[model samples]
Target: MAILVLGLALWVGAHLFKRIAPGMRARMTERMGNGSKGIFAIALALSVVLMVISYQRAAFVNVYVPPSWTVHLVDLFMILAIALFGLGSSKSNLRGKLRHPQLSGFALWAGLHLTVNGDLASVVLFGTLFVWAFVEMAVINASEPRPTPYTGGSTVGTIRLLVISLVLYAIITAVHAWLGVWPFPG
Candidate 1:
């Protein structure tokens, strides 16, 4: 559990460094010269790996049990989360409307996961992330409002994003099952 917490701190801390301390992050990037992004990426990957191992090995203590019916909400939230994530990260018209779609997706993912998973570790992991995402979005929007009006988003783009999101969702759910937890149990 300690390791898991440490890993989470590292991963989320680095990712949110710019949001929290833009000057510090910028200074560090300049000091690192050309390898800054690469160095941070490697560190972030390592932190994520550590988190996975620590989380999987940690003991699960029951904190609260969410109703089983919330599993349906989890499924819905997970799919939309994935869709928004894909659209947000892609160079599509959707980005016009959802300036921070990826962060929004992550917030949704964490919030929805909390509905289904009531373990202390899950709460510690997902809950913090949920709060962090919202904070990041609010801070960013307040500082940097979207300049361009949304006009390019189209039905065709929406359809493509939907298909891609669905496919990714299927793959991710299968990976979850492979990891030994079937979210949508048969």
Candidate 2:
């Protein structure tokens, strides 16, 4: 639990640093030059490792039992979540529809996981991340100007996005199954 909490804090702090403390982030960037990106990447990766390890090891303390229907909903929405996650990089027409598709997808992912995972550890991990995504979005919106929506994306791009998302989603499901957490409810 200690490690999980620490990881969560680090993850949130690292993500919020640039938005919350521009001056400090600028100073660190100046000092490290190109290394700043690598440092941030390492920190983020370490946080993920810590969270995963600690979460798996955490004792199962039941929080609240979720309705069985939520499992089906989670499965369905997960496809949309996965598509939104890759929207930023894809040339999909829907890319311009959202200002923060990736973050939105991340929030969706966390929320979906929370629906099925009623354990204290799962709640803490996913809830913290879900809150962090919203906070990050708010901070970015406050600090940044309105974005120009992307345009000129074709139907081909949209098809590509859906295809890639489906492939990636399948892989993710397989990985979860291999890890002893089958995503689909039997």
Candidate 3:
């Protein structure tokens, strides 16, 4: 639980650093030069590792029992979340129309996970991310506004992104057995 909390804090803090403390980030960037990306990547990767390990090891304390219907809702929400996340990077029409699709997708992922799993570990894990996404979106949008709406994306790009997202979703679903937490409520 301690490791999980620490990981969550580090993950959120590292991500929010640039948004919350622009001057500090700039100074770090100046010091690190091109190495900032690698440092951030390492910190993020370690944070995830710590979170996964600690979460799996920690004792589960039931906060509430989720209804059976929420399993179906989780599936539905995961698809939308995956689509938004995967398509956010593509030159698709939806990308142009949406602001902060990736962050919204991540929030959806975390929020939906919380809906189905009402445990202390799950709450700490997903809830932190849920809040971070909103704060990150606000800070980023305020700091760097999109000067122009991307209006040149094609239908083909949209289709490609959806197909890719579906494929990626399928792969992750298949790997759930290895992860030991099947989203399906069987």
Q: Judging by TM-score against the true structure, name the best candidate.
A: 2
Per-residue lDDT for 106-185 in model 2, tens only? 99999999999999999999999999999999999999998889986878999999999899889998999999998777
Candidate 1 lDDT over 1-186, as tens digits, reads 888788888877777777778888788888987677787798789888877888788788999999989999898778889987777655566667877888989999999999999998888888888987888788888777667755666777888888888999999999999999998946
Cα displacement (angstroms), candidate 1, residue 20, comes to 3.0
Q: Is candidate 2 or candidate 3 better by lDDT?
A: 2
Candidates arranged by lDDT, highest first: 2, 3, 1
Which residue pairs come into collision in candidate 3? none
Q: Between 1 and 2, whose lDDT is larger?
A: 2
Could you arrange the candidates by TM-score from highest to lowest? 2, 3, 1
- In order, what lDDT does every prediction score? 0.83, 0.93, 0.87
- The backbone clash count of each candidate, in order, is 0, 0, 0
Tens-digit lDDT track of model 3 for 8-80:
9889888988778889888888999878878888899999999989998989799989888998998877888
Name the candidate, 1 or 2, with the larger TM-score value.
2
Cand. 1 Cα-lDDT = 0.83
